[model samples]
Target: MSKHVDLPDLIPVFPLPGALLLPRARMPLHIFEPRYLAMIDDALGTKERLIGMIQPNEVPGKKAGGVHRIGCVGRITQFSETEDGRYMITLTGLSRYRARDEVEGFTPYRRFNVNWDGFDGDMGPTERDTGFDRPKFLDLLGRFFSARELNTDWDTLKEADDELLINSLSMLLDFEPEDKQALLEAPSLSTRRETLVTLIEFALRSDGSGDMMQ
Candidate 1:
């Protein structure tokens, strides 16, 4: 899908640690907190139903540097209200943005003025990693999973396309917040793939006992 011409400059942001939403990928989120529930309600009233997913950077003393500079904007594509008033929502990523400024408002949730520069390709089309080495990657992945005693549908993973396989693994893996942030900020699919491999290799080398997931 092409970029939305009406994509707003200001957007509500959800500060979640280790949560990532890459373009062309979908993330399922549960809205339970009162502040976030209000954020959802206000987002649903917008034309695009858009929200920004960002990671919080807690500095030792600087409270101003809380939110990360980069984030992915996603549109709420699926939503359902539970019996207790919580919301189950799926966000389909639209683009990666740089949070230029924090917009102070009376609303409960935080908002940001974002810049979509350098990420035009995010909204253009799904990307494929031409240099992806599937067999080798799977071999490493198998070892990693086995070390952690993690079970997955190997057949299904084999059938998934390059983008889906890489991005899904990047999202689902129990990597540290900084590691996941690196994956999110990677410029391209191939770069992200390389980053994923390096992360896994590091995990393997650091501890064969599979304590990497911890």
Candidate 2:
């Protein structure tokens, strides 16, 4: 089944070159670039302050901020203009999209023509019995804290629901650009959860930070 939605003609987006937004996750961004400032301006002038969150391929070049194919569209749930004209906005992701074409801009930002006519992706089942040998996903998180010697409240960490747990882990993990892009491009939530588990397991075996494999 496909979940078809009427996307706005002009969606405000912030391009984060290497990061991906899983469905239903909230990404808080600090907007400082001039082009993005123009984007915020354009969005605030319209009814929907929805911005597509996409990642650039590399940095420090003319097209340094060129984006990946897939990205998530998010609504500005919380925002405030800073004293220095920067926008601190929290984006609540609504759906993912594939870039159709690129738009030329005089500013330092890039925009894409998105195709989101039929968005069918869903967060799959998370309660299935895998019957694996390793500890629960929450325990792996605890192991991550201990292995990295980082301090966090384990009780709260353990209490987070599966979606929150996985999304939070994805945001905090040190994943490669392509690996992170793969996670973003995952068709469903269960797949992203599984990928995070695999990443955690790999990190456990390789002394803390290790390469994330697809």
Candidate 3:
């Protein structure tokens, strides 16, 4: 079965730091700001129902804070409105995109002209032949979790496939914004797993200072 949707030349962008959305991964977002609330409303009315999630640059006094070139487009799967006019929505990732151009101030929210050529593979099944050192990684994760007192479901974690484990952990873990972007931009699942392991190790070694993990 093929899952296909029309790829638009232009798309609405949500610039958030440390929020990573990989293809086939679902990310939940809270839309409270007037601009992003408008974004969600527009997406609901559109045929594609897509929104681009990109990381913003680290800089002071910048509007939209400058977004990264690469991003992932996700379809709004579920949404509910609060009495305060805020929206709670879950985005099901469809594909990854690279920004060829950005159009800011065109709307209350941000918009971008995206090219999806490089990440065509993201929509397909991730490679699993390379294998993962699950036990070793799990041991490291155990240490990190113990230090932070974060609970873990050993059964579920052990049963998850490589792609799910790698992508989900990368998104869930509290790495720096740039570190999260690095995981999002990883060329392959294999590399992402490696990067994630390195990040966890680095975080464990840190002394309460936020350092960008490689």
lDDT of 2 by residue, 69-158 (tens): 778887677889999999898877677788777776654556677877555543223322233322466566677767888887777766
Q: Model 3 clash pairs?
A: none
Return the lDDT, model 1, position 111. 94
The total of clashing pairs for model 2 equals: 5
Choose 2 or 3, whichever is better by TM-score.
Answer: 3
Q: Please report the TM-score between candidate 2 and the true structure.
A: 0.79
Model 1 per-residue lDDT tens digits across residues 71-149: 9999999999999999999999889999988988799999999998899899886799999888888988988988778
Please state every model's RMSD to the true fold in angstroms: 2.9, 4.4, 3.5
Please identify model 3 stretches exceeding 4 Å from their true place. Answer: 1-3, 59-64, 104-106, 207-214
What's the candidate order when arranged by decreasing lDDT? 1, 3, 2
Better of 2 and 3 by lDDT: 3
Runs off by more than 4 Å, candidate 2: 1-6, 9-12, 58-65, 106-108, 121-135, 208-214
Alpha-carbon lDDT, every model: 0.90, 0.68, 0.86
Alpha-carbon TM-score of each model against the true structure: 0.94, 0.79, 0.90
